[model samples]
Target: MSTATPPVSGKLFGLFCLASYLLSLSYGSTFLLSLLISSRGGNEHDAGSVISAAMLSTFAAVIVSGHLSDLLGAARSVALFGVLLVAASLGFALTPGFGHLLLLFGLLLGLGWGVFYTLGPIIVASLVTPTQRAKYFALLSGSMMTGIGSGPLLGRAASAFGYPVTAAFYLAALASLIGVLLFWRLDRQLKQAAVQTTAVSRISWRSAGQVLSSKAVFPIIMVGLGGCVFGGLSSFQTSYAAARSLDYSLFFLGFMSAAISGRMLIAGFVVKRDPFRASCLLSGLMLASIVMFGFVVDSGFTYLLAAVMLGVGYGLTYSVINGLAANEAPNGTTAQSLLLFSLSYFIGVFGFPLLAGKIIVEQGMGTLLLTVLAVASLNWLITVGRLIWRRLSTTRALQRA
Candidate 1:
């Protein structure tokens, strides 16, 4: 890897981390504001819907924007996305009514995030090689963890600052705006003629299908959903903590800090030894964390335990899944794969949570959690079964040859 790539010099990478940090911090703190809606008297579905709306909308936009970045180039797409994010933040600040404005903000923010979500990783990948990916990925993931962890602290800051509960939304928007400026600077550096670059194109559905038909990529996708399990679990931690009377903000901080540490601090160790085995091992760990979460009743220590377990799971699953996504990027399929990966992840993050919300409503949070555990086990089982089949087929082919 060339030292001159993105000039990780003098807070260049720090700025990239800052951009991501704001994205997560702003989004995570939304939970606090969501609680306000409930305090003012909203239903479970109402809050869930608002959260889901933001994720779902962002999910849709990211898939589209990510592919465009490949066709258009990471720097250009990033700067463009930054501009949209500022616009969306302003829109969010201006929306007056409940549900109505919430939905509109959701759309605008989603658009901004979609562009970013797509471009963030893509740009990072463009900067580093596969061997160096885990470290960079971990650093970026760590920033997100910090942002998530800061949710409660930021909420407290919001209060002391004498801002409205909705003020957190504007603050998040502000952070993202700052990120835009940082990314614009980075973009200028990346576009220079002196920087050696590789050209890549968007993957078409036909080619993507061909990649999917491959023995390795297909299995990776199913196994890849393990990444989503961590995502789904994180989605519910706020309610789980609050039900136990834990400070919602604190719960976020603890959970996020652990996860951030896992990614930023611990991920390199796992990646250094073996990215493939690390990935497989993380899947097993995620299953274990969910099982523990299913049975634990007292949160005094349970939340911390669960957070650590979940953090490890997230760090493991994401570290590998991200590498796999990068590896699976067929010669010209970078954007297409990114789009599809975002779509798959969003489905897991947004769609699974919506489904789980129903389970929470009918059976209760505990039951919903048990269901998540079952889903994790089941998802893992399916992956194992596929891998077993693939191994056997490979053995047979070798014998014939």
Candidate 2:
């Protein structure tokens, strides 16, 4: 196989971005899964458990997807997972009760997400040169946020039309089907461009494990913590809003809007500078956003503002840290680094909700928020520590010279 880097094509990249948007939209609609659980006579805890269980499958998929991509090729792997997502979404509509829903969504939908999320960036990395990677990554992130951000609106629109929440599942299914076809088309285009060679590689477990080096630890931890905050906030927003008589959609709208804009407008500038420092600043924003959501958000405006702060904070932070993860990888380990990054992130994203759900049920949203606040603060402190450490190391090296 030719190992030469493929020339980048704008049209191919555009197709990839469009597919990402649709795939994410399919996944994002599940942001309202908690409401479905409620309608099924389940509580917050059940919602958390089911969602977390589904995420467990996502975790498994992340691990398997690298090898799958290596074996079947990236585009084919993505298309395969996309098919699974479609089946899972349709299953959500046809399944009778909580147990069936759990089995289908948890295993199939979660697995699809794991593969899609993990491979999307790897494919992008292959398509772009190092100089163009950051900008393209930001654009890809923006496209995904647009789709994810639209998910809540899709659910709301369904309800407005008197369709049950399950209707959103069918919509997700449709989106996934379209996304799959796009990936298929992209695969054909890639073949014609001769960039198809860039997509296939042999990835091993031992190679994937190399991402655990010291350089990657900080970003991994920070993204994981961000996941915790996101998992808790997004997973239970329905109950949180209901308790306050506010609209949950405000949070998603504000979050996606700010996150998408931040990546488009600010991420390019920030990613070019000191990532650790930028991450520290963004962490502070995350901290404030959590506090605002927990304590200060009484009205819809406050809620939206809090979400926007979070969008600016976590959203941009994610991109910066992701860049760090890819950049800091030991040479030849970019794929492994990204896979590990996604795995760590899913752990926090899916793991926390299971716990937060119980906390919301037993102790209320206040306690959950406090817990998330602490996690965010720790993430900030760690980034600051990493920054300080880097500076000190540089100073010592100069002194030695």
Candidate 3:
């Protein structure tokens, strides 16, 4: 056989997509954990804290995983995260009390997810050119969304066996293991084929600083800010549905389905054309979703529409942002650049919900919705300002020339 690496065929790419889906299926518990905590006598605030804790831990892990990705290589780092997921899952299955669940569910699960999120895209980016990046990214994102959509259903089904909450974790662990194996096999095949992948001797604060200083930093921050709404929705959407007397699962289905449709059908075209424009649209949609939630008064149809809008907006936004960050990755520093992107993501995920949890406890979901809407609107305005600034600069340069 030729020593050259085999080209990534459509079939191989499809399998990778499948791997993405399986990996994401593990996230179904993200929505369930809050309810689990609440059911076990932890109040809504405490349940929100669990999500906040997990996201905060994820933020920390993404920062560390950047360096780890450089040292260990993307494939090995991903496998390591998978191992963490397995351990965390087993821990969740066996934990006897709330404190233990916090560690297992909040910390370890966050680490696993953080690494998986950090490296999976780098792996895919390595396999494609800058031009093909957005499309492939959308596919991977769509796959993950598919998994996220199915995760709750999986957890619900697994719960039928016994110990419903624990069963969800157990099932997630099993599914995560399968995903790891699939990814590992793909990695081995790529290595055997001698395909080049991201590798570096060391990464540190210095490298991260370099990325922070780059032009991409502003857009990355905008993308991350958009996630604040996502963080709020993740922690509260189910409860919000409950308050409105809408079916939680049904609402999520509409949301996830819209998100998937946006990614698979619409993201490629919009992101490829102008990521910034897509980001603006996504932020606007998020703001609208929050507005719908804030004003909801027993209209199931209105609630479902809001969910769908949130899903489509977030779905398209994430794919575009990831693609933008990937495009900005300076030679051999792909992982570090991506880490910056991940950091931005979890900042919103960690900060917004934590603060909103407090607001929800004190003021109510209405106040929380207003907060998200305000932040989202600000983010959109910032993106639009960036676009205008770039245009004005280009115009000035032309005049000077």
Candidate 4:
């Protein structure tokens, strides 16, 4: 029940980062689940459905795991989900054909992702001083981005060597298992050091309600919008590339490269100063990138350019929003606020693909891009609006005084 922040340890932080990277690599490898569905005779709709199912499962998992973390402790909760993730990856590799079973595996995969993704930030928040959180958060995100970005390239390499794409799933399983072990070690170290984790003592509807209505709502909404843009683009990049006679890997390469660099080098400095204004600028960049991708990206060079812009824009924007969510959280409700943040983001990331699949099937990729562009525009507008509102509110309060 103590509210004091735990003392940071350099060794434990490194272990957490390594585990996060490996776990993210496992999740990122599955980004190509659409290809797996195709190989098994499933179509776009089927792929979308499976992905959405996983996302919804993630949504549920975030809520459930938040409570479980409080009860069982962060390390145990993470390990349990990590085991589920490993099992799901193995199942994807070994499953004979795509069917309802694939949906089941997807759900399992999502459940694992929800836990790790939510808890990773909580652990970092506990480890770092408030003044250092922005840098550390960006660094943590950079580690995750590096792993995620590498996953698709690994799949591409396997394909280049004429290995079955499914072979990547086996690698994913291995990465996840390693992540679990790393977390286990981290837990032991924390216990030995007697580091107090950020886990809350209890969760309740009243606290959840307060978090929902708190300033955290702004970041939650922004992240959800960003999630929609990310989900729509990443989930369907393969199809879009094929339609344009481009390699899908280019998108991942450019996006991950820019995103990683920005998080590592740029995000901490800019975002920590004025997160709201930074979000607005980055959101504008994201909108421009989407516009270029949707309307002007004909050559591979242009495609990569758009992807890079998106990487800078959305990637940095996400980190800023994440920090905002944590900083703006009401006292005693950081865990719940972050839980909602994860849930909102999952909804957009996993939910949009279902609609996007339908749009691609009926209206084509052009329509899909336009829709995503619209979402990007809306996200930017919201960012700008929130910043303006906050300034006005501050000015009015001073006037009243």
Model 4 per-residue lDDT tens digits across residues 283-397? 9999999999888999999999999999999889888888888889888787677788888888898888889888888899899999998999989999888888999999999
Off by over 4 Å in 2: 1-7, 191-205
Candidate 2: residue 374 lDDT (0-100): 95
Q: Which portions of model 4 show Cα errors greater than 4 Å?
A: 1-7, 191-202
Q: Which stretches in model 1 have alpha-carbon errors above 4 Å?
A: 1-10, 66-72, 83-97, 156-164, 193-198, 201-203, 215-231, 386-401
Residue 98, model 1: lDDT of: 46
Per-residue accuracy of model 2 over 342-375 as CA lDDT, tens digit each: 8888888878889999998899889999999999
Model 3: per-residue lDDT, tens digit, 1-401?
A: 22122246767778778877777766656676656666666655775676667776787678677667667666677777877777776675576655645654667767887888777777777676667777778888898878877766555566566657667777777877888887777776645432455565235778777777776687578767877877777666667767777767766787789988988888767875776677877778877777777775367778778889889877887887787777775666666787778768877875677787788889988888888888888877876887788899999999999
lDDT of 3: 0.73
- lDDT score for residue 299 of model 2: 94
Against the unseen true structure, what C-alpha lDDT does each candidate score?
0.62, 0.82, 0.73, 0.82
The residue-by-residue lDDT of candidate 1 on 13-88, one tens digit each, is 7777887777665555545544555555654555556556666676657646745665666656766666655665
The candidate 4 region of ten consecutive residues with least summed lDDT is 1-10
Q: Quote the positional error of residue 301 for candidate 1 in Å.
A: 1.5
**lDDT preference between candidates 1 and 3, better one:** 3
Q: Which pairs of residues collide in candidate 1?
A: 62-114
